[model samples]
Target: MHFCTKFLIVITAFCSYSMELKQPIVSYILNKINNSEEGTNSRADPLSKNVEGLEKLLSETEALNQTEKIYTVEHLVKSNGYPIETHYVTTGDGYILRVHRIPSSPKMNASNGKVAFLQHGILCSAADWVITGSEKGLGFLLADAGYDVWMGNARGNTWSRNHTTLNPDKDAKFWKFSFHEIGLYDIPAMIDYALEKTGASSVYYVGHSQGTTAYYVMLSELPAYNSKIKMAANLAPIAFLNHMSPLFQIMSLFEPMGNFLANLIGINEFMPTSNFFKYLIGNKICAEDSVTEYLCTNALFAFCGFDYAQLNKTLLLFIIKYTPAGGSTRQFFHYGQAIHSDKTNILSDLD
Candidate 1:
């Protein structure tokens, strides 16, 4: 057989085998759980009962009509009966970021006036923490536990695409930053604001992916900020890129051409969120029960790894509405450089 034909055959076989393995296991486990829960107290088996209840709660949002839904982190928080406040922080470098806060729950104020700030990963926004909604969203859960929940949107994403003078659309300089700037400027500014507002000397910081990268940059560049944070929880923290996945390692080979590729495509600001894409992906494709829903799930698995049993099918649509919120090509290229060079915590080419 021809080389191309042989490759196609192998790819087809792999996909077929993967699907065969995925579907049956998921179906069997779900069916088994449902069968075990039916018409039984099963209180003795709290784990099974909790799993079933959790699944039911996750699916509850699936019934919301498309018209009734407002696709935003603030809307999700408010509609679920939690009070949300929108605050803007201007970074030292002039990028204006929109931050979200769940100040208090119905029962009490922030735990002894404590403050917690949540930061999202690359190509994401503050919406990530609360997108799953009240039942399971970490933002809401933290609020209910009496912690002041604050979500920060880094510059270049959906929420922080503005600057004091530079227009993101017109000024290439506005798109000049990577996650390095976010750590060096944005994180400290937001944290200072949180401390000033809450009168807390320090904050509990939580970050995911590039959020964690920003934290590393802040500590590396400005060690004084360490005294300002009570504790930091890094989720899927990314700094060293010496051991990347095979797929990303291959992509890093083009690091030498990063600037050329970025310029050739005329892509300074990458994947900015807009209403058109929100509707296309959220309403048209990943809408509840849509046939194309699997495309979104498969796409996520392609990059993030596959854990079909842990995938929340119902909130997939809402997540599609908010993600890839926007980023800069340079930010991505920086990661590529790190992976290719086997560097740890190298913020930019100049560094």
Candidate 2:
């Protein structure tokens, strides 16, 4: 057989195997689409329609016997056969944040005290570092490379939803923070906690997307924090928003109105659970048999530029399950402020 012909044969067989394993999900999504069309009328309230759609999605997810549930950072780390530790660090503003650590791994032997810190993006948790599994995940890679790996969850995310005095649900003050607070408070606390625990003088920092944004804010605003890090590696660093996605542009336009309504209703958190978002983006688009899957995936790549070779279709469902974990409305507004500003700085004034 010709070389190109053999490659095509291998690709065809892999895709066929994937499709066979995903048949249950495809059938579930198809049934949900049909049921949604029949049960929901055009005049139905948007909220009601979304709730119905979310319930159906949840039901189908529960019915899938093959789907493994790994919801939290701890769950993800433990599943990969690595020893994990949970440490809670209290910020200067009294926010208690959860930080996950992989102190030592038997697979790789190196100095036990060398430290490396990993931070997640906006509306994401430490689980983001482990979602790709042990082979490819940066956390696992760092751990295997003999660095004491630590992953920090920002204040408003699912992992760090606690305060010393204020209740996150009842107290608006608990929700009244943005990346500025995260940079100045959360980052320092995590770094200090890791150093104190490991007895290390300086640690290496690695951040992705909003993680990189917060690091910039920290170093710029509090230049003294520069001493705590040995070196920094920024992945997909986002400093300015002069060129934003179409969806973000639309969001920027409505930000003022959204802020006003949030103030009027005393709502400081934006789409905490985001069931509507899950239903619309997670189910409607990522569904295995959906015709619009290509469009939805392309939409994700529109801003960053698509690389089909880098795409991993197999992890789509699990990715959706844990993402949009939660963030304060202030975080969204902060990004909006960045988009509108000419300067590459953290938005100082949220109100």
Q: What is the lDDT of candidate 2?
A: 0.72
Residues 47-69, candidate 1: write the lDDT tens digits: 23555653453344344535434
lDDT winner: 1
lDDT of 1: 0.73
lDDT of 1 at 12: 31
Worst 10 residues of 2 by lDDT: 1-10
RMSD of each: 10.7, 10.4
User: Where is model 2 more than 4 Å wrong at Cα?
Assistant: 1-69, 273-285, 292-309, 347-349
TM-scores for all candidates: the values are 0.77, 0.77
What candidate 1 gets wrong by more than 4 Å, as runs, is: 1-69, 242-247, 287-291, 343-351
Instruction: For residues 1-351, write the lDDT of model 2, one tens digit per residue.
Output: 223223333433333343344444334333444555566444322212455664675566556534434466788888899999999999998999999998877688665567999999887889888889999988998898889999999998888889999998899889888888899899999999999999999999999887988898888888888999899999877787766544455456777777778778987875464443354456655555454354344444433434558877667656766776788887877777666654365436465
